[model samples]
Target: MDDDSDVSGLRATLRANPAGHWLSTPAPQVAEQLAQTDADFVVVDTEHAPTDLESVEAAVRAVDAANATGEDGAADTAAVVRVAWNDHVRIKRVLDTGAAGVMAPQVNTVDEAEAFVAAARYPPEGHRGVAGTRASRYGRDLDDYYERANDRVATIAQVETAEAVDNAGEISAVDGLDALLVGPADLSAALGVFGEYEHEQFVAAVEAVLDASTVPVGTLATSLDEVDYWAALGFDYQIVGVDAGYLRTGAAAALERYEQVGEE
Candidate 1:
């Protein structure tokens, strides 16, 4: 499939069934493995992870490779990079890596949201620099990529602060801003109730975002229960699991099993 179609299909999938997973380890192999799963999309998390630009590119390639093989015959999984911040350079470079979308952090105002969208889109809509990068098959598909990028590339702004929640309605209404993701950890901390997902203040803040957003809203869930909780609360989509979380859980489980066998 062409790059544009990949992103277009991703938008459709998210609208129809908003389920995704996260990669925090920055390993291309891990990304490939995850991409081969039945996930609707996979987020390569650079915001909190140690993923550099090169690593991000490799991971994007791995995801593409895995999607091409369809080893398990699962549907194609789009790769979305959650950049470290809402910076123009970072946004442009990562998009060059052929990511299906970008999820920027801490977009707290309408202006910030607009800037985020502008940086991700090309001219006529915004100011993303044109390039013959991997996104365009190194100039082979440049014209086509440029033509469809503004419409196809997903631009997601993270609502992680009290101010952002306050501006959610305006931010969501920004043209070319495709979605809003709640940065639960940062948002809770910003609300002065760190890790208190159930605290009244935090709950109220989240509800405010839900109520205000005109675009699809989503959040990250570290476990199946959290998945159920967020889905129950009506989040349009969710990044359901993190790679580090999986490593920690799986390792702990194996160690516990080993100790049990030794005891027996």
Candidate 2:
């Protein structure tokens, strides 16, 4: 409801060059801190993180607050929710909480992609349940919100299987689908090469999705080192680091420094 920020820019950014972090830590404060980063957007990974709707809503609020006065100009960081599943009930809950986007994992076919999009949208476009939730300013921004929801809310379908890669084009072409994300680990496993990032078959499957996608494509870089690799491959977006990964890496470095001091 904060009209001052004009977050519609996120829609364009996701379709263009989205680069950001993944909030694997299920905390609202973490979302607030990361939203202030130079990243273009951040996705709260509810699929893997033990995040409930309350924390997810809090995180979404934090993101909006951070973006309100963020120095990134029109490139403000957007908050996306990676819901636990593609179920309409769960997707509707997240949308009602005001997340800028919703990402569903393991979307392996055109029907799955369509279902994801439908859940993210309201009537006329889809059958999402309406409510006077935060997204509509608790009824204050009703008319405007309803009119803009379909256009403003982004829908991302993650392609994480061999089947998804094969049907990437059809999935991407779904009417309301905005983007396709590749789940590298799951995808590689399905291709019979778990963790083999450079295996020929795994690489081919990734390329297959990339080549077939009609929308912006994204994948996890797993580390800061691989950011450019994925980006250079023509990926529209890339998640360079996750909250848990950052925490572990920082903690390990600190312990190493302490050990060096003890040796000295």
Candidate 3:
């Protein structure tokens, strides 16, 4: 895609809409396939999944290709990558792959959030070193990418710890930090109430993060059933399905169907 091409789908959609859903996966092909779906964005999970930079780059290219030729074909679907941590080198590498954004995990403090934003941005804003990566169209769009990247590229910080919840307001207020996401399972564990979403402390912690956040915030729902509850609570985005979840559910259902037919 050209530097002038509308590569800001995820950012623009988040701005215009109240909430959006994203598909998270570790597989590049699946990432490409889902980008063609109604999902607004696809996030390649590099932290938990055994995904390397090469795989992440492939996924980003897949999203770019899928968006290039879909029905409405505005290439509006975005591809975001969730890095393993809030490190400068990792963040810069992924951003160079032309992703719409990078989601940094375990940002439990304002300083960590600032560091993430700095690494994702360029000079004057931060210290991100520029290279002729695919993001710059191999030096062809170097000038344009340099000028517009800092504004267009998103920097999402994950608020998955009790400490982060306490500092949510400050983190959200940091310049260049685009969004905040509460990692439910991790936060629950951090609160000493693992797997108990309805526990008072778990609920309260989630609410605290929600109340403290000043910018767009998001979280991962265990299932589609929980989406409305989260949306009502003011989450700007929700991740409902992971690639593993989809495969597991589908495989289980198919086996159950086969068993039922045999019993009949």
CA lDDT, every model vs. true structure? 0.86, 0.83, 0.79
Error of 3 at 133 (Å): 0.6
**TM-score to native of every candidate shown:** 0.92, 0.91, 0.90
- Candidate 2 lDDT by residue in tens digits, 203-255: 88888888988788999987766786777667888888888888899999999
The parts of candidate 3 lying over 4 Å away from their true place are 1-9, 17-25, 68-74
lDDT of 1 by residue, 66-91 (tens): 87534643237888999999999999
On lDDT, the stronger of 1 and 3 is 1
Residue 119, model 2: lDDT of 89
Model 1, residue 98: distance off in Å is 0.5
Please state the error at residue 60 of candidate 3 in Å: 0.6
Over 4 Å off in model 2, which ranges? 1-7, 69-75, 261-264
Hey, what RMSD does candidate 3 come out at?
4.0
lDDT score of model 1?
0.86
Q: What residue pairs clash in candidate 3, if any at all?
A: none
Clashes of each: 0, 0, 0
Number of residue pairs clashing in candidate 2, backbone atoms closer than 3 angstroms, sequence gap of 3 or more or interchain: 0
